[model samples]
Target: MDLTGPQLCYNYTSNVIGPGELKTFKCPASIEGRFVRITKHTVASTALRLCEVIVEVNADTCTILDLALNKSATQSTTYDDGKDHAGDAWRSVDGNLDPNMPVGQSCSHTDQVGHQWWQVDLVRYYHITQVSIQNRDVVPHRLGNVSVEVSETNNFDIHSEFYDAKLCHYYEASDVPASTLLILPCSDNIVGRYIRISKFVPILYDVLSFCEVIVEGGDPSCIQGTTGITATTTVTENTTDEQTDTTDSPEITSTTISLPSTCPCSCRGSIEKYYNRSIESLLDELREELMVSKKETASYTRTLVSVDDGRTSSRNIGYVGIVLLVAVGLSIVVPDVVSLAMYMKGK
Candidate 1:
């Protein structure tokens, strides 16, 4: 171990400890060396106080998990202009490895041309060891000439590939089989907060589409000295035009995602901003609450039917309740459905 070298096992930046107060720092990864040295720099020479130091291996280092499942994802564009949101980018990390589209509705698609890309934010830096991707069952050749990259920053351009990133793997023409899951192992140094798959060279009907993406790794650490919370989140953006009829529209909650954890300091406000600004988030809340209300209403109706004395009255009440529920559901649902359409168009 180079004590005076630029590399470090860990950096401590917390406040000084008082008497009888113990401070612990955990290294992100295992650091194997012969000596464990502690150094403190001060402007002037001073007496040093000593306390017992303890070193233990982090159990999390041995536990490898999918770091990209249900995390925030974005792509160059939604396929077919978000007609039914069947080609949204969040589908790749939804833990569904189905390679079929429309039938399975499990894939992230982008517009034409090989200049498109899709990415997932891990919310923190991790030593990414492997990336598993599933190709679409139909026209699997469209997913050619792609590169899997990792970066610590989100400074990406839709039309450009200029960024501080490392190339982990590149798949040239027919590298991955059709309707198959391919797992590519990355280098040990392939550690970053963002894992992006980009295609630069154009081919026949070149488009970026994936059914699922799984990032496996462990030994995570905060990025940029900021402590961030990690959680399962999915953000959907509908670009469909507004329409008056809501009966034939697709369900907005088909791709379900839960709310994230409390405010994470290391998120850099991007995740929080997305949830607050996205109309889909509000629609999700409204739809979930509506479902809960519908269930409760049905339960109440069941209870009333069970306690009724007359069969005729019970049948009449049940029929009336069903009609009323449908009416009320339409009355509230139609307006929001229209609003969602308009919101998507506006965005």
Candidate 2:
């Protein structure tokens, strides 16, 4: 319930999010918590609104995997028709199944120019067993006649464009419906780093769109089976002392559970370090400017004090000049006869 204390497992500081933009943050390790809390730290006049927040946990088993989750994905061409929304390729493997393409902002779309395809790079070889796809709910027919192909190398050529990779499953026009989850299993021993859903045959005004794509499989080189540990619980009863006036006896219980060191990862894009660097640089610049301003202010103060001292010296000299002038005028008006006569006799 509290932001700090034992309940708090991790803290995340976010950067600016643009309008209609989705930002993702990935934790380095899986954190187990009862609730996920979000709080704003900036002082801005705008309101804080969250479109969605998704938390993904590890799959049940250690053998199977979601290999394509948040992996590198690309499309042939993004759908662009003077619209503010996007049909980016990364949306397919973003682990979001919201099929409403228009407002959901979770589906991937391609232009209706020619042959369209969306591909994900697994980064490593995996013996892919099955691929799950969710079609766009708005226009379900756009995902028909798609071929799920796998290849170790993604290099395409004139002859055998998919680099002669094996086809996992091909879906005809009537195979899948709108907003439906289709599970297509590949042939045995289909090992590759790239999985592509493509429509190769040229058709006029044909576009490709899908909500989500999940690639599940095991490591090609290593396949180690994992098991989970069961939790154990112990209960103890405390007896109340006769002298103490407590009526009920309290029960104390403790449980021991072992968590997996590593969990199935759906990696997300992180800007944590980027924000950290920006903030540090900003503080350093502010400190340097503050020091410069302090020096300039001190120098200006010294200059003002020096000017005042010069004015005071000039005023004192003026007073001495006025006194001499008054003495000479008085001697002219009424002469000092005794002192003058003495001075003349001495001369």
Candidate 3:
């Protein structure tokens, strides 16, 4: 069996399988497909058989989401055995895992050929994680070296081939087993809208078959939204303190003052002139106080000099009075002496 859309999706092949044995195949990447087919190569002769076919989906993690339920499916060819049909691929994905019906009702198949394929279209892009395929219980060994691939473009031109698709997973003869589901995980995180399953090598037969294909992943664009904040600035010419708006704007608490027009040319010059005039007036007051203090000091010195001269004159008058008293006593004593001499001579 082969899976394809505009590009090749997958290819299935194997050596051989025992009778009444079942198997599975898985894809590593989530594959979106619009078509699925089963056929044979021009040089090989082998028929395709399938008990059922399944497709699943997943998101961010490894959890599986049933995205293929009731989705559209198609095949390249159907078996002439009047029992199986191409729509059986959809019934296999309808939550039915066991094949207890008749042999024709149990699976889907195609005529013997080497270039047969099957495909499906997911209609959108998803972050795919894993794909699983279940084999039919009748003849599962036909799916041996199967390759599964995915792509977004639908360029299935015969001349160009399906060159736009990328390989998601591939299995060899040793990798296929009997009576078990095959699981493939996408290690490289492959993303696409179309999934294709195809068989490249012919083993027991050139047939490609599967019971189901499941895809799982999350939406690539289901992210949360965020809000952002913006800031604004305003500029104005010839603005004053009174005209400036402080609400919803930065505050200006203080400002510089200019000199009044009635004053000097500049505020600094006016201030300097006022300071010089005040200093001169203070200096004149100090000079007047100093002159009055000097006049008082000179008057005090002259009074002290006049009082010393008066004391010297009073001391000289006292010496002259003592000399006069001594002269009067001497004159009285001389008269007494002359009288006494005269008395003696007369005796």
Best by lDDT: 2
Error of 2 at 161 (Å): 1.7
Clash count, one per candidate:
0, 0, 66
| Per-prediction TM-score | 0.45, 0.46, 0.42
Candidate 1 local lDDT, 140-172, one digit each (tens): 866777889888898856655637777778877
For candidate 3, what is the TM-score? Answer: 0.42
Ranking 2 against 3 by TM-score, winner? 2
Which model is ahead, 1 or 3, in terms of TM-score? 1
Off by over 4 Å in 3: 1-64, 84-89, 99-106, 159-161, 201-205, 222-347
Q: Least accurate stretch of 10 residues (summed lDDT) in model 3?
A: 222-231
TM-score of 1: 0.45
Off by over 4 Å in 2: 1-62, 222-347
For residue 345, give model 2's deviation from the true position in Å: 99
Clash pairs of candidate 1? none
In terms of TM-score, the best-performing candidate is: 2
Which of the two, 2 or 3, has more lDDT?
A: 2
Candidate 1 yields a Cα-based lDDT of 0.70
lDDT by residue (203-243, candidate 2, tens digit) is 65568888889888876533332223345556666654555
Better of 1 and 2 by TM-score: 2
